[model samples]
Target: MSSDTYDFIVVGGGTAGLVVASRLSEDPRQRVLVLEAGADTNSDPRIKIPASWVSLQGTDMDWGFRTEPQPLLGGRSIGVSQGKILGGSSSINAQVFVPCNPAVIDHWNSSLGNSGWDWETFSPYYAKAYTTPPVDDSLAVKLGIDGWTGHSSAHGPLPTSFPGNPSHPIRKAWADTFRANGHYQTQDPFIDGAQGSFSCLATVDPVTKERTSAATAYYHPNRARKNLHVLTNATVERIRFDGEDQKRATGVVYNYNGEHREVTCSKEVILAAGALQSPKVLELSGVGNTKFLGKHGIEPVIDLPGVGENLFDHLVNTTSFGAVDDLETLDPLILDPSVGEQAAKDFAERQTGLLTSMGVYTYAYLPIMEHISGEGQKRLKKLLQDNPPAPGDGPDQIRAQAYYKIAERGLLDPKQASGAYLSFIGPWGGPPEPGSRTLTLCVMLSQPLSRGSVHIGSKDISAAPIVDPNYLSNPLDLDLFAEHMLYIETLARSAPLTDLLKHPIIHRDPASDLTDLETARKWVQKNSNSMWHLGGSCAMLPRQMNGVVDSTLKVYGTTNLRIVDSSAIPLMSTANLQATVFAFAERAADLIKEAWSQK
Candidate 1:
């Protein structure tokens, strides 16, 4: 092999890409190379401070991709923020570290035809990705985390902690309100997929109060290893194959510093460019539908039609209410510039106050039927009965039918959480009053029935792919999301939680009054936005089922090529995708190690 050749070439030095590179390079004999299109922003404070996450979007650190106008969202073009920095979305995200509903993972194996991917087998990888912060006795009781015993793991590369002031009234109020409603969590969510309210974790180092991104946790620590090499500002155009008939990825063609370059890999090529861009890479390399490739003037290598299909993302709608005057919300941070100085001082001095938090401390995963009324329940049942899964035996239809069956079962089951709700301690879509604070309730559809696609618009790799999430396109999705939105009103009006808000319920947006199902539906159509938890563009299942990759994360009809990112997740997780993405990469690294070790 030449000096430029390595054992493995990993594309997109993002969250999953870093994890795989770090793990694969553990053996001294193996040589690994990582190509990242974005610059290394790991040292930037905007990427380090937990509260600075929101500011990183639209800056140099973000990809700044926008979705096509959706008819359901009043024809609005939503901004899809992807991290273009070294850590990828993990560096730019809000840092909520939550797990997928275990039941959903079970579906990946039992229903999606991916063996050894069940919750029991995949759960261990979650433990391998992060070490949970310890909860003190007093804080545990206050946060309702006392019941969460004997579940957390103390070993992992990433550090996870509960962000914000532990004694913040919102934390106790949230837990008490859920308990009063008989919806308090029964077990730790990390260990069991229980549906209830609880305080969630963030990827923040407890000691340093800095963001624990994949770059900081995985890459930075292992970067000194001689076997590992990383190139930043290197944009991979496509995979370089051995030949048209062989279909083996031997190297990659990337552009760096205004010059195109090629580097060969002796072993394997891993694609971790994320859900939005991974499919673009595969399609550009001639692994997609021949018709689509030919349209872009690219010759075909493998005729895989599922390269960019089955796109899934969580859609969220937020409603903000006025908070009590005494409560400390993040509103002042934006409204008052002086508050920023104090926050900076407080963080520098003691690692406390607004700088240490993102003002989103509480979360709940609840079943739709449990929150809706009897009439609503009947209506939901009728909706499901009236519109069954798409009828067909073809690959795309089969995949859709399988997802519909699983979604239907969970939608009806009281034990399953169809909606993920969280409380943010500030106004979300509207401005706050001069003398008043705000509390925003975000209601998200955990499992969406609608599917979309991301495909290349031109042969040029620099051009962004066309993204259409097709959010709320399915009739059931609109109705189901409306039900969840209506429930948010109930939660806000409920006990202890209501105490945190002002009397008479002063809403940030008067139109957000979710009085009835119809009103809620109208509000959702206009207000809902992407949660940025995109996945499944390159799913893992049988090839006949519109699966780009198989159970082993290997692309079909191709050797030495695999996808180890959110793009390969068949079913989107229940809540935030960072934790799930971390676990998935951890498991993929093990799988890759096992595969090559045998050779």
Candidate 2:
């Protein structure tokens, strides 16, 4: 029996996994092990250079899972790619690091009844994890002073900053455009207000111009510690239970170096696999929806019906226009050999240029509802009036109900769910034309009324999970998308945005007045895409609500087992999930530490 034993075994060496492992091993005596099914990509160039982010998708670094053909998305099978590298999605995702709406977190505590998990409760964790360069004195207030620990400094190691070299001069114009449209403008995106147009902060070092991923930020610094062991290319087959009762998790079975290996955990086994794969992992371990287990010919160890349900994410609809002038978009710099050579030389020599900026560093958290025309509002109001209660009593259906209620509230209040997320960055693939510059207006749905599911297609963990995001299944979500789409069309043609554009109407034809809702809906249907903000597949609701985990982040119907990733998120409450997720891991670590200390 060639095996190893540890104090804790964290499944999935991704963002949350690394955070938990590093924190737990800080005790010096605890032995922490991290099992990752992907290769360590610290040396990957695509990961370090901010501009090369788009190129990493669909490659070996991506999990490459596509949704079941969405009935609402023109029957299209959209890709819901997960990160398949050491840092996980953080290593592959765009470097946009932003804050979650405080109200949304408050909802999880007050409205959804998740105690000890609110804005005030978790603010300290966020402060403990986020660090910025050229430190702002006001950030001193963001450093957990809101009554949690009286007062503290921002001591966490993760660094977030603006573009190292510089941003395009147009950033001022972008800020002016938001202000012109009556939106609140901010110097820093992570603000107490949580709504407004602001210059975005990237999870990159200001000096090196490299992505500050979970591995780089949390794990690598602590790698020299002997208590923390990271096993790359290690696939956890299933968690082993202490007994046939399946009440307690004892260890895990994994395949490493072409051989099955077992590892015992003296204290606990936490599953930090992301939303997409975490539920599948539970199902494969016989701890999911009983009916699903029966259908898949797996013995049901626990009837936790919520393990792989409640999948949802922001559905982004993008429109790219031809800009009159070059805007430092990655297209030309990487697409053209001569320009790419210069970019490479500059990056290596000076750590600057097009490669440093991710092309887009500003995000407008717009209150799209207020900006919508009377006609659009009237149409949406009538539709909301007619929306039937989401049909099933199942957990997924209950989640759909909660999602709609919150989204409806957001329409009336920007502080609740942000109205929409807008960013500019694209000229993707090939340029639209020769010597043509590009400007992409990305409008993202902050609170989608859609619910989907993920289940194991095979007992094999290596096989892709059956993902059905069921996008736009709820007409209301589509209605919001349409409304925002039409609104952005107007913004693109407005004074500030249009004044800066070389060609206003090149890529888009806002010819339609959108007197009817269907006109806007048709346009959005043509251009909708996932924003890669996947979560809620394994929610943390009340047990009767089909929750896979509880507010304490402990798995329902099981002891010594927990899932501490986006999978446990009750809803997608943020735009970019990295900041929220890192903060979440910090909080979870405290909870685990408390529990272990009591033992």
Candidate 3:
């Protein structure tokens, strides 16, 4: 084989690309080349420890890309961080291990005609990619092993441990109050088709207490493979194609060491450049809508209309409250050892420590109740028949009434929270709304109805794309978010949590409390931002959807071109996209192996 050519040229040595390149290189007969846009992951300490991630933002290792001003989010530019290193964003993300919701999968399989993506079918791939941590009986009992990524706890590579910090009297009292208010503690949060409040674990090493990322899990152990060439500080411009047959993706043109070079792929070219860059590559390659291409002075190729559409992200609105008279701000014993040596000893001996804390210990999920399920429509109707809203009260008021009823049961404590944490929902797009207090309650609007596109900024491959997410263009999304905010308001005014808030005098701007609806709308417009979970710019779809790739993970217009990255998710899953992305790569590897065998 020539030095310039290989069996596969995998673009982007991050999570998905590295997984595919590693698995493919297992066969010495086939050569795999992984091109990365940033440096190697070896020197970054932040990449090694899970808790160290907060320090990595805007660093050289991160792409640190900023989005165009969002109209819904007060026209503020949101920050997006992607690892430019070998592991991709996985090298920098908080190692939260959550699963794709079953409802999300069913929507993909049943509605999108992607047959193999359903939960039952994709379960094996998830298990294949995951290396579970060791867990004691207590932790395992809390996070069930029945249907999760195999109970590898006994001898798994990853380490899973609960926080060892003994619950403070105030913390215990508050948690107890939560139960009295009606919110019950749950065992496992990831059980199939289930939602509940439970303590969770991060992806870390049991022995070292370090974060376990894809770069470490997949690439570091196999760095010596002769056929595997990993290049860093090199940016990909676009896939080169033969004009005679625009469908064929021949090779890629990239710049490394300040020089331009063309590399050919003997068999295939796989794109794992992620959600934001994948579509930009396609547009640069002339595979998107001709008009959009022509407007940018690029020649048209595949003319796929949906190449850069369907952008989705999550938004997080976080507020901290003084739930108890004693401050929970920072545990001196845990954060700084000058106060206590026992805290450090506990953290070192057992992986459980104060640093392992997820500020918000409990995360709850509440479905929009008014949209009654097949079983609850009549019950809702009957309840409404007995106590209907006043003649002119809108659906928001009706929903607010139901929200208050649920709040009475006490799952959420608004007052305990210093402010609202706006977290993005999943599926499509999201919306924004107005509220009060130093911290206002808000929804992530993870799933939004608005669609946006991504196109190349110029011919320079290393240059990032022009991204337009068009956030919060849907009214229904805004309404749902507003309903949840009101529910939180009710929760904040409830008993136990209210006591905590009274001492600290949590204040809100008077502007947020306007009686006129339009005035309140302005406040919401000035304060929304993204959760930074951007995806679906290069969606996987059937031929009918005019998608970029097929179920086999192969690029639609080219025989040897495949995409194994976040760009391939047809629709955003309700959970974080990282874990699901690993599963996608795991499954893509199997398909690639099978296709290779046929030849």
User: lDDT per prediction?
Assistant: 0.89, 0.75, 0.59
Top model number, TM-score: 1
Estimate, for each residue in 544-597, the C-alpha lDDT of model 3 and write its tens digit: 555667778777667777888988887665545666787788788888999979
Task: Give me the candidate number with maximum lDDT.
Answer: 1
- lDDT, candidate 2, 276-362, per-residue tens: 888887888889878888888888888887777888788777667767665555557645789888988898898977788676666
Q: Give the TM-score (vs. native) of candidate 2.
A: 0.92
Ranking by lDDT: 1, 2, 3
- Candidate order by TM-score, decreasing, is 1, 2, 3
Report the candidate with higher TM-score, 2 versus 3: 2
160-261: candidate 1 lDDT, tens digit per residue: 888988878887888888888777776677887547888888999989898999999999999899999999999999998875555889999999999989
Candidate 2 error regions (>4 Å) = 1-3, 135-153, 243-246, 370-379, 391-397, 414-418, 428-430, 508-516
The estimated TM-scores of all candidates read 0.98, 0.92, 0.78
Q: Record all residue pairs in model 2 with backbone atoms less than 3 Å apart, i.e. clashing.
A: 324-502
Q: Residue 583 in candidate 3 has what lDDT?
A: 74
Worst 10 residues of 2 by lDDT: 143-152
Report the poorest 10 consecutive residues by lDDT, candidate 1.
369-378
